[model samples]
Target chain A: DAGVTQSPTHLIKTRGQHVTLRCSPISGHKSVSWYQQVLGQGPQFIFQYYEKEERGRGNFPDRFSARQFPNYSSELNVNALLLGDSALYLCASSLERDTEAFFGQGTRLTVV
Target chain B: SQELEQSPQSLIVQEGKNLTINCTSSKTLYGLYWYKQKYGEGLIFLMMLQKGGEEKSHEKITAKLDEKKQQSSLHITASQPSHAGIYLCGADLGGSSNTGKLIFGQGTTLQVKP
Candidate 1:
């Protein structure tokens, strides 16, 4: 079991630029959710996708979006980034809506 | 705004001691979950309490939810260095329109020194 895998372990971008982080869910899992964790804070839910369709969205602005691919991989895209966007982007996978979740190491995004 | 509030913001204990962290929510939760996170790491789900007055135990940790449905506590017995981490409590509202979306507390950082 490789667990959930997130790409671009760390990234740096300037304000107003756009960045896309990716995640590969655990094998045999079909639900993926994105969360943003600022320093010294608990992660805040962002978006959720299951079976290639969006299941739910959090309080994040419209500038943040995500999509789950047919193969159960997910991509989180953030546009018009601000310094506040600098945080750890976490991806969690679940077998289905009814089960517990497994999280990845997360992608650290630093916006200057 | 976060409806959930966690207590003691941080705590330090000697190895082998016991520690308790608390979580309180303004709205009734259909479910409450506890998670542990090491420094700069992802969250590890510890336990989930769904019904009021529910209690669950896992290894050295025990979690209890009050009958009022407004508060919960996580108690770790014989804490070890491996148990040092941030403890977070989250609530699932289980609204008619949403089920899994959770509201998290600020988290309590636990440090166990040998």
Candidate 2:
């Protein structure tokens, strides 16, 4: 089966702009989570949705939000982006809320 | 302070050598996961350990979760150049109800020389 897939493998945005990243989970998966990885650092949790509902959120600012669809696809949106927002946005999916997750190639976002 | 800490920010070893990487958590870990990532690529899941003192292996890679559940280690026997990548350890500290939100450590980058 195909693994988690993310869209727009890369993106470039300006400060104060908004961007949306998309993710399609593996078939039969019901959980999708978002993470941001800065250069040379590991990923940091952003948001997690299970069965189309928000289950957990990390320490990210209000500018970051995400939602899962009935089909288990997800979108992560960041508003009023700042240069600091530049990073690799990764989407991960699992069979359930707490199971092992597989990640996507990630959307590389660069804000200037 | 970082919730998860990984030792040896980077490693370089000759092929056929054995090396170990560690992940320590300040809080009790509900689940510990190991993943590998090449530059500009997605993470490749290696192993997951939930039970304390649990140990699992795949080929030449072995992962162990300490009895205390707060420490984990990954050992590679007869390392090969294919093992070169960023090794990351992710921890779930939200208990049983966690929804897959993971706190990851600063990855340990490994470089294997042939």
Point out the worst 10-residue segment of candidate 2 chain B by lDDT: B91-100
Q: Compared with the true structure, what per-residue lDDT tens digits does model 1 show for residues B14-112?
A: 999999999998878767889999878888889988778999999999999999888999999999999999999977765422323677899999999
**Model 2: residues >4 Å from true position, as ranges?**
B97-99
Candidate 2 chain A — worst ten consecutive residues by lDDT sum? A93-102
Instruction: Label model 1 with its docking quality class.
Output: medium
lDDT by residue for model 2 (B1-114), tens: 788999999999999999999999978989999999999789999999999999999999999999999999999999999999999999888788353799899999999999
lDDT per residue (tens digit) for residues A1-112 in model 1: 6999999899999999999999999999988989999999988989889889998899889999889898999999999999999999999888886567778999999999
- Give one digit per residue, the lDDT tens place, for model 2 in A17-90: 99999999999999899999999999999999998999888998999998888888999999999999999999
- In model 1, the runs with Cα more than 4 Å from the true position are B96-100
Best by TM-score: 2
TM-score, first chain, each model: 0.98, 0.98
lDDT of the candidates, in the order given: 0.88, 0.93
True contacts kept of each: 0.45, 0.82
